[model samples]
Target: MSRLRPGLARVEFYAVWNEVSELLNQGHTYRSAYEFLSEKKKITMKYDSFRRHVKAQFAKKKFMEIDSQEKSVIPADNKPKRVVPATATVQAFDSKNAVPLSDLLTEE
Candidate 1:
């Protein structure tokens, strides 16, 4: 069979792709996702090749999601915007009574 792409031809590439996807779902950036896999010795492709694959996959998935959402029956104006209430507010403390930064650092 003829190869579809230069980098994703190998089965190993799919494994790496899945890992990158999972990492991204967990809030990792593309570079950090690949870096995590590299640190764990789970990826075989070089950084540039791996990065290209990630960007391509991410873009493809994003486009698919947008296409699907656009096809939904619900009108865009009817959709509810998510609103999160603030849980806590910061209170300023007196600098005179606060512990010194150097002391806190040394304690750790």
Candidate 2:
């Protein structure tokens, strides 16, 4: 069923989203940001809703940063590849390469 959008929905925020984020990122308090923005343009959303909506932007920005960092970290196999430095040689060792306990206990 088609329904009419709410008053807040009628407010076009995408155009000013960047400015809103910049204001918050500059360390302005939510109250100050809300007040400042509301004065510049009519904001229908209540102060509390404005605070939550703006904070959600911060959360989204944080999440995106963490997600991008995670993407750059670790290979698909889950094991990180090591760079071979000339100072030291890396070796892969397993149980098959280990000396038997009996051999260690017995002296030739």
Regions of model 2 farther than 4 Å from truth: 1-11, 76-108
Worst 10 residues of 2 by lDDT: 1-10
Q: Model 1, 1-108: lDDT tens per residue?
A: 233455453454577677777788999887897778868977656767777776777788899999998779577679678999988988889898989999999995
Cα lDDT over the full model 1: 0.74
Which candidate gets the maximum lDDT versus the true structure?
A: 1
Top TM-score hit:
2
Error of 2 at 83 (Å): 30
How high is the CA lDDT of each candidate model?
Answer: 0.74, 0.71
